[model samples]
Target: MSKRVASSTDDVASSKKAKIQDDDDDDSAYLEEHKIVVEGGDARPIRDFGAFNEKARHQLEAAFAAPTPTQAISWALALRGSDVISIAKTGSGKTLGFLLPAFHKMEQKTVRGACSPQVLVLAPTRELATQIGVEAAKFAPAFAVRTATVFGGAPKWEQNHQLKILGGRGCVVGTPGRVNDFLDSNKIQFSLLETLVLDEADRMLDMGFEPQIRSIVAKISRPTQTLLYSATWDNKVQKVAATLLRNPVKFVLGDAGTKLVANKDIAQTVEVLDESKKTARAVEFVAAREAAKLIVFVATKRGCDALCRDLRRTTKCDALHGDKDQHERNRVIDKFRKSKKGVLVATDVAARGLDINDVTHVLCYDFPKGTHGVEDYIHRIGRTGRAGNKGRSHVFVTPQDSNLPALVRILQDADQPVPDDLKQLAFTRRSGGRGRGYSRGRGGSSSYGFRGRGSSSYYGSRPTGRFSSSSSSSSSGTKIRF
Candidate 1:
C-alpha cells in the first residue's frame, strides 16, 4: 500500500541499461524465426534444456505439447541462475517460464527451516496469484514441490496453516500486500529463498504495490535469483528492473516500445455507436454466438452486475468484479471455465493475468477510459485469442470517449480495419470540431451486426450498413438477432 519507490542500489542503478544480445548465440536461427529479442547477458536460446528430471519432464511435455517461445528463452537464462526480465504478451505461458526454473532450483537446494519459503511469486491480483498457484500445483506433485497461495479476501488462518505445512521448501505465490503482511507477522521467512518471480510486474506497479514489493525484497538477506515477467516494457518497468534485478537479461517479444498493443491472434472489430444502444447490441451479439464462451468487459462494478443480469436472461452467465468476495469470484471463474458456452461479465479486475482457454469471444460492452485506458483495452480484448487459438473481440465506441485516437492506433497496429466512424471520432478531437452524432436504430443497417461464419466482413463497410448476422436459431425456434 506504500506509494514510495523501491530503494535502488547506487552501483546497480548506474548500470541499469541492460546489455543487448539477441542473435549472438548458436540458436540465433531459432530466436530469429520466433522473433525473440534477448537483452542483458550472454545466455542463448535453449530449444530443450533437458534440465527437468524424467518425471517432471514427462508431465510438462504432456501438459504442453511443446515448449512455447516464452518458455524456451526463459528456461535458458533462469536455469543458469541469471536475473532475467522477460516481456511477452498475455497467454504466452509466462507462469511456467519462471515457475519451472524455480522448481529446478528447488531440486538442487534445501530450505532453511520451518515457515521459510524457497521460492516466492508475487502477483498484483488474487485471481492471478491463485492462477499461478494452480499452474504450480500441476507440476508440484511430480517434482515433490509443495506450493501455497496467499492473498487478501482469503482467510489468514487458512493461509497460515498452508505456510506451516509448506515449511522450508516449496513455492509461495501471493499478492504483494498479503505477502508483505505474512513477512511482517513472522508467518513466513525468506531465509531459504533461492528464487523470486515477479509475474505481471507492470500490473503490480500500476496497482501501486511498489513499496510492498521493495519491502519484501529488502527483507531478503541473500542475493536471490530474481526473474521479472511482464506484458509490455516501459520506463517504469525498466526502472523497477534495475532496482531489483542484478544485471538482468531482458528477453522481449514484439516491439519493446512503450506503446501497448493487442495480440495478433485476436481479430478485433471496433464500432462507434451511441451509449444507449450498447446493452441491446451486446445482448444481440451474445445471443448470436450462443455456442461460444464469451467474456463481456464493462467499466464499472455496477455495470458488470447489470450486464451479467441481462446476459443471464438469454444464456447461463456470471459476473466478476472487485466488489465480489474472493470466494464468489472464484466460483464464477470456475463455473465459467467449466461451461461450454457461458458468459462472464466483468470489469478491469479480470483484465490481466487470468488465463482461461476456450474463451472464444470478448465484448467490450463499456470501452476503457482514463490514463490506463489503452492498457485496459488491450488486456480486455486479450482475454480471448489465447494459446495460439484464434478469437474475436468487438468494442463499442461512443462519441464521449476521448481515447479514440489511441484506440485507432491499436486497431491499425493489429492489422485490423478501422471503421470510418472511428476515424471521424478521432479526427473530431484532433481538428477541434464539435462531435457529429453517431447513428442508432432498430434493424441490421441501424446497428453493427455480429458476423457469423461465411460472412464477407465483420464490421461491414461503415457503421450504418447491412452487417452479416447468423441465421442459427435457438432450440425454441426463435431467430437469433445481432
Candidate 2:
C-alpha cells in the first residue's frame, strides 16, 4: 500500500519526455501496414508462430486460425527477447498477443514439472484477468503448462489453493490489489519472473493502481521483459513506461479498421439537452435508434441508476455498475447479449473487459473524462461494430462540457470527423458569445436547433434538441435523430 511518488528531478523529467518522443516515433512507424503484416495479409498469419518453440508453435496452430496484428507483434518481439508496449484497438486479440509469449517463456523454463510461473500478467479488472486465464488455458495443456488467476470478488482461499498447486508451473493472472496481496503474503514469488504484461495499462493507472503496480514491479528482478498494453498511450502511461520499460519497442495499430476516426462505424452523434430534459432526451434518442443491443455509459453510479430507472419506466433498459453483485453483472451482460434491442446502463467499469459481442449501438449518456475515459468511450463504442460487423455510437454532450472541443480536435487529428456545430461552438467560445447553432439539413434551418424542444430554459444550463449523427458503415438504416 506504499505510494511511490514520482520525483521531479530535472534529469528524470527530461529523460521521461525523451522516452515519450521515442515511443511516439516507434509507434508511428509500427502503425504502418508494412510493419504490421506477418505473411502478406491485413491480419497476421499463423506461420510466424512456427519460429518459436515447437510446442508453442503447435498450440498457436491448433488454437488460433490466424494471428491477430497485436498477437503477431507480441510473438515476434517476445521471441527476440525485446520488450514491447502494444497500443491497439479493442477486440484486436491483445490477450493472445502476450499470452503466446508467456507460454513460450514458461516452456523454456519448466523442467520435469518443477515449473514456477516465469511470467505475470496484470489486468485492471478481474474479468479481463479471468479472460486472459481462460485463453491461456486453451494453450497451456499443449505444453503441459498450468495457470492460476487471483482477483477480488472471489474467495482468496480458493485462489491461494490454486496458486499453491500451480506454483511456478504456469502463469499467474490477476488484478493489482489481489496480486499485491498475494505478493505481500509471500504466497507468490517473483524470483523467476521473466516477463511482466500489464493489460489495459491505461485503466490500471487511471484507477490509481500506480502505487500497487510500482510496488509489484519493484519486487520483480531486473533484466525482465515488461509489456505495457492499452487501447491508447497517454502521458500517464508514457511516464510509467519510461520508469518500467527499457527502450521498449512500441507498436501502435492505427485507428484504421476502428470505427472511431470516421465516427461512422459506431454512430458518433450528440444530443444537447438541459438538465431537466436530459432523461427525456436520452429516452427519445434510444427509442428512435431502436438498436438491436445497446450499452449506455454514464459518468457516475447515480447517473447509471437514475438513467436505468427512467429507461425501464419509459423504455426497456437495465443497469450495471461497480456496486452490482457479480451475479447481477453477469446476468445483465448475458441478457444484453441475448436480447435484441436490449439496453444496459453502466459505468466505466463495464466499459472495458466485458466481451458482449453483437452490440449494435453505444450511448454515452455523459461526457467521459481523461484519456482513459476517452479510451473507455472507444471501448464502449467498440462493443458494437466488432468482428468486421457494422455498429453505431451516440455521445450526449451539453454546453457544460466545454472540453468536448479538445476531444473533437484529438479525434480529428486521428482522422475522425467533428460535427459542424461543435466547430461553431468552439468558434463562439473564442469570440465570447453563443454562436449560431447549426441545423441538420438544408439552408441551416433552426428547426434542429438546441432550443424549445423538451425544455427551452435549459439552453446554457442544459442541452435541448437533436445533433448530427453520421454513418461510415455501408449500412443503409444508419440515421441521426434531431
Candidate 3:
C-alpha cells in the first residue's frame, strides 16, 4: 500500500511539470509577438486602450494610433499599482507612460487640498521639467487635474501661487533642487503623495540629485507607487532602485547596459575628417538640405556660440548653452520648435531631455567627452528620429576621440557601414602611437594643432559614393575643399 501511494504522488508531480512547461511556452510566444521583455514578474501588454476611463482613452486615441511598446507594457503594470522600472530609448513617449497611470490613481483616490499633490514627477533639468509641464497641460484639463511646475530658473512667487490654486490636489513636476526648496519652505508637502515618478532617472542620478530625491521620498512617510524611466541602466541605477522600490516589475525595451544602444530609427554616418574641416562640412550639409530642421552639438558654450554665428550667416541659426539665462533658453527652444526649418547649436545640456519634433538631421561638431561618450552620442542622435519619424546623424571623427572601438561597435549593431579610415584610426591608436588631442579656439577658428607621426596618414581620402559633397556644392554653388 505504501508503494502504491508513492507511485500516485509521482504521477501527479509529472502532470504539474507538464502544465508549467506549457504555460512558459505561451508566455514566451506572447512576449515575442509584442516585442517586449519583462522581468521580476509576468506583466502583459495591453492591445486595446478601451478599458481606460473615457477621458484617458479619448486622449490616447486622439494623440496616437496605438500604444508604443513601453506604453503598452507600462500602462498595465502601473495601473495595477505595481512599482515599475522602464528602460527604453528617449522619445519613446515615456512622459505619457507614467503620467496616465498617475492620473488614474489620483482619480480613484480621494482628493486632497492645497500644497498636497497626489503625484510628483522629478526631472533632472529645467528644460525637461518645463516640457513635462507642457505635456501635463494637455491631459490635466480632461482629468480635472491641476498641475504646478516649479524649477530654479522660474520665479518662486509665481510657482508658489500656482501651487496654492485649486487646492493643489493634483500633479507636481519639478527639478529636485527646486522641489526640495519648496518642501523646506513648507510651501509643498508630500504626506498625501500616492504616485512618485522619476523621469530620466539616470540623468538625475548623474547630476547628483540622489540626496534630494531621498529627502523628498522620506517626507511621504508611507508606501506609494514609484516608477523610474531611463534611457540607460547600470549599477548606480540598480542601487537607487533597490533602496526605493519594493517588488517592482522591470521592463527593458531593448538591451540594458551602461551605454545606450544605438537607435535604429536614425541612419548614422561617421566621417573621419580633420578638425579644421568640420565647420565647412556642417555648412555644406545644411545648405544641401536647406529646409531640414537641424540640431548641431558642440562641446563648449563658447564653441556653440561661435558655430551659431557661422551658420547664421547662411540661414536661420540660434545658440543655446549653460551661459544663457532661463528666459533666453526658453525663447531659443520655442523659436526652433516653431520654425519650418532652422539650426540650433547647443552643448550637452540639450542632449538628454529636450524634445522638438520634425528634426531631420543632427550634426555632431564636437563629440561628447568623458567615460559616458557612447551614452551621450546616442542621446544627441536621438534628438532626431522622434515620434517614429526617420532621421539622419552625421558624426565627424578625429584621432583625438578615445571611444573609437566602442563607436565601431555601435555602427556594427545598427548595420551601418564602417569607414575604412575609421578602422585604421582605431587600430593605430590602440597599438600605442597616441595622437596629440585637438582643441577648438573660442572663435571656432581653424587653427587647431596636432602632433604625432600618424596624425594625418591613417585616414584615407574621403569616400565619394554616397557621402560626396558634389550635390551639396552644386546646389549652393560653393565648393568645399577637403
Candidate 4:
C-alpha cells in the first residue's frame, strides 16, 4: 500500500511539470506575435523576433540590436518552397536576411543523413564564402546547427571532414566552383536540401561561374526555396532568376516608381584632366586627409604595381590585384584594415570581395574600359560609403575622342552636374537619349550611351581606341577606409 502511494505521487508531479511547460510555451507564442513588428529607418530599435525561439532570439538580438533595410521584411516567412529575389546595395545586411530564415527552416526539419546540406549558399569568391561562414558560426551555437565552408584555397579534405563528420546535415557556404567539385565527388547530399541562396548573383556571372552554378542547381531534385540577391541586374541576372525562381516577388527599395540606382549618400564627381597631371592630383587628394583611408582603382596589373610603387615613396600604400596569391592579398587587406590612414592601390579584383569599414573615399585613377558600364562604375564607388556611411566617389576622365562623350552622357544620367571641362569635350546632344531620358524604366538604362569601343565620334574628331595618359607614376586608382 505504501509503494502504490509513492508511485501515484511521482505521476502527479510529472503531470504538473508538463502542464507548466505548456503554459510557458503558450506565453512565448503570445509575446512573439506582438514583438515582430519594426518601424522604418534607423529611428528605433527592432523588437525581439517573435518567430525565433528563446535561444535564437537572444543570440540574434545580441549580435544585431537594430534592423537593417533587409531585415525590415520578414524573409523567414517566405521559406515555404517559394522563390525570393532581393536586390539591395552592398553592406545592406543581406547576409542575415536569408541566413536567419534558412536557419529557422533548418531547425524545423530533421536531416535524413549527413549526405545533404540543409542549406547551400554560393558566393563568387572565397573571401565572401568565408565571410558568410563566419556569420553562420555566430548563430549555429544558439540553434545547435552545424555549418561548413568550402572554397578553392582551403583544404578540400578538411572541408570534406567538416561536412561529413563535424557537420550533421548543416549549412554549407562555398564558391560555385568548389561546391560543384564536391557535388561531383558525391561528398555532399542534396536529397533533403531545404534552401539555396545565391549572394552577389551578378558578380558570380561576371566571374564566369554561370556553368558551375547552373550545373549545381540542376542537380538538386529536392523542393528547395531559392533566394537570389544581386546588387545590379542585367540580361544574365534576369536569365538566372527566371530559370530558378518560381513567380517571385520583385521589390525595389525607394519611392514607389524609382528603379535601383547608386546609393544617394555618396557624393559623386568626375574630373576632366590630362593624363600627365593624374599622379599630381592623386597625391593632392591623399594629402587632403593625411589620415584618410582611401582606395584607388586602376585598369591594369602593370598600372596597379606602378602606382603602388610611386605612392609608397611619399605615402604608405600597398598594391592589390589578382596576381597576388590569397595569403599576400589577405595580409595587405588586413594591414590596410588596421591602418588609420591606409591606402590600397588595386585593380578590379578589389571591387567585389573587399569589404572594409569606414572607407572615406574611392578614387578612379584610370577610366574604366568600354565593356564596363555604369554598373561597374557603381560597384567601384560602392567600395566606400558602405552601410550608410557618407563617402566621396570621384572618377577621372581624360579628354579623348573615345570616352569623352560617354562620360558626358553617364554624368548627366547620374543627375550630377557636368563640369565645364567635360561639357567642352562633349558634342551637341545627339543619338539615343533624346526623349527617353536617363530613366529608361526598370533596366536602369541610361539614354546617354557610353559604348567605349568603336564608336563614330559625334564630337570633334579625336583619336579613339583606349588611351590613358598616365604620368611617370603609372598608378591608376586607389581607395582608403579608416
In model 4, the runs with Cα more than 4 Å from the true position are 1-65, 74-81, 109-112, 153-155, 255-260, 338-341, 401-415, 428-482
lDDT of 1 by residue, 1-482 (tens): 23343334544565553323334544777778777887777557656637789998887667667777888889889988899998888877778889988887887766557888889999999988887888899888766789999999989999999998885467999999999999999998888888899988988998899999999999999889999988878788889999998989888877534468788889988866545455666777788887889998887776667667766777778889999988898888888877888788887888884688689999887778788888888888888987768889988776766688889898898898887767866887788755644333334243333332343212221223222222222111112222
The collision pairs in model 1 are: 19-40
TM-score quality measure for candidate 2: 0.72
Tens digit of lDDT per residue, candidate 3, span 239-279? 99999999999988766444457778888888766544556
Q: TM-scores, in order shown? A: 0.85, 0.72, 0.84, 0.73
Model 3 lDDT on a 0 to 1 scale: 0.78
Task: Go through the candidates in order and give each one's C-alpha lDDT.
Answer: 0.78, 0.67, 0.78, 0.68
- Rank ordering of all candidates by TM-score, starting from the highest: 1, 3, 4, 2
lDDT score for candidate 2 against the true structure: 0.67
lDDT of 2 by residue, 1-482 (tens): 22343444665889999998896666445546423522211222233567566766776677556666577677777667777877777767777778776776676656432324677899999767766777778778766677898899887888888777774456899999999999888888876778899998977888899999999998886468888887666789889988998867776666522223332345465554333445666666677666457788887775677667766755788888888876687677767766877788888777776665577778777767664445556677777766446676777655444556555765575455566655655565667754335343566442223444554222122334323222121211112452
Better of 2 and 3 by lDDT: 3
Those runs of model 1 whose alpha carbons end farther than 4 Å from true positions after fitting are 1-26, 434-482
Compose the digit string of candidate 4's lDDT tens values, residues 307-416.
Answer: 67766767888998878876787788778777777889888777776676578888887766566555567778878887557888888765432355666665565576
Clashes of each: 1, 17, 0, 14
